[model samples]
Target: MFGFGIPELLIIGAIVMLIFGVGKLPELGSSFGKAISNFRKAADGKDMIELNSKKDG
Candidate 1:
């Protein structure tokens, strides 16, 4: 993907692991997932602020 081959991907993944560490991987992944979800919702014209207010109320 993105013009990256297997070796390039493995190297990038290793660098990420070194920077974030193994323990923080899950938390980072969860945050990334949430961000993608929010972006998709926003792209679909759903307002996040209104949704949050509704949830809180």
Candidate 2:
């Protein structure tokens, strides 16, 4: 997507590390993963509320 290759990705990653710092990378990755998961669930019409309640019980 956007014609971004390995070089472009490396540059972008370096910029992100500079801006957010290495310590924050894991947090950022977790947040990104959650966002993608939520997006997929919403697109598939999955009910998160019910799933959460079921898991708790």
Considering every candidate listed, which one attains the maximal TM-score? 1
Q: For candidate 1, lDDT tens digit of each residue in 1-57?
A: 689999999999999999999999999999999999988999988855653444554
| Candidate 1: worst-modelled 10 consecutive residues by lDDT | 48-57
Native-referenced Cα lDDT, model 2: 0.92
The Cα error of candidate 1 at residue 39, in Å, is 0.5
Looking at model 2, the pairs that clash are none
| Predicted model with the maximum lDDT | 2
Worst lDDT 10-window in candidate 2: 47-56
**Can you write out model 2's per-residue Cα lDDT over 1-57, one digit (the tens) per residue?**
899999999999999999999999999999999999999999888844653444554
> In model 2, how large is the Cα lDDT of residue 17?
99
Segments in model 2 whose C-alpha atoms lie over 4 Å from true places: 48-57
lDDT, residue 22, candidate 2: 100
lDDT of each: 0.90, 0.92
